[model samples]
Target: MRPEIIRLLNENQEFRLFVRQNPQWYRKLSRDPSALQSLEKEANYFYGRTFPQRVERMQSNLGLAMMMMEMLKMGQDTVAQTQETFSS
Candidate 1:
């Protein structure tokens, strides 16, 4: 491994983790340090570690949760209305 690549692996936890998970990158990077860019892009895409991807995932989860809450509230309201009708 090149000195710069060694230093990068030591300094960047994310890159280190990525390389650990995908050992092929180690040989690729050792042969051509310039491949680091493509490796990072692939890692980001594979892990959904990019900011926009993370934000989109969070938004989708929030929307799902909100819809669930709305459904629960509507269910409760229906039960209450049914009870009121029976009591009358």
Candidate 2:
């Protein structure tokens, strides 16, 4: 669940969008008794029946994911550029 959620709330929005499009994702979450109960608790305490709260968290995670992605991309690009220069 954690990984999937992270993937969803990522720079690559396809996983998130896929989960949204597929009801199975929600259903699976619902069927997970432990996780569902825990989520309900989180929902009640944090979200308090407000969808915006959950979305806010999701967006925050997405922002983090994007940052990580940018950092990784920058590193890779740097390495590639360095290799090109050194190899030349």
**Candidate 2 per-residue lDDT over residues 1-88, each given as its tens digit:** 4565454336445434554665565656645634544444443554235677778889999999999999999999999999999999
Please give, for residues 1-88, the per-residue lDDT of candidate 1 as tens digits.
Answer: 9999989889988889989999999899989999989988988888898999999999999999999999999999999999999999
Q: How close is candidate 1 to the true structure, as a TM-score?
A: 0.77
Residue 43's C-alpha lDDT in candidate 2? 37
Candidate 2: lDDT over CA atoms?
Answer: 0.63
Best by lDDT: 1
Collision count of model 2: 0
Deviation in angstroms for 77 in model 1?
1.1
Model 2 misplacement above 4 A? 1-49
What lDDT score goes with residue 87 in model 1? 100
Clash count of each predicted structure:
0, 0
Candidate lDDT scores, in order, read: 0.93, 0.63
Q: Which residue pairs come into collision in candidate 2?
A: none
Cα RMSD of all models vs. native, in order, equals 2.2, 14.8
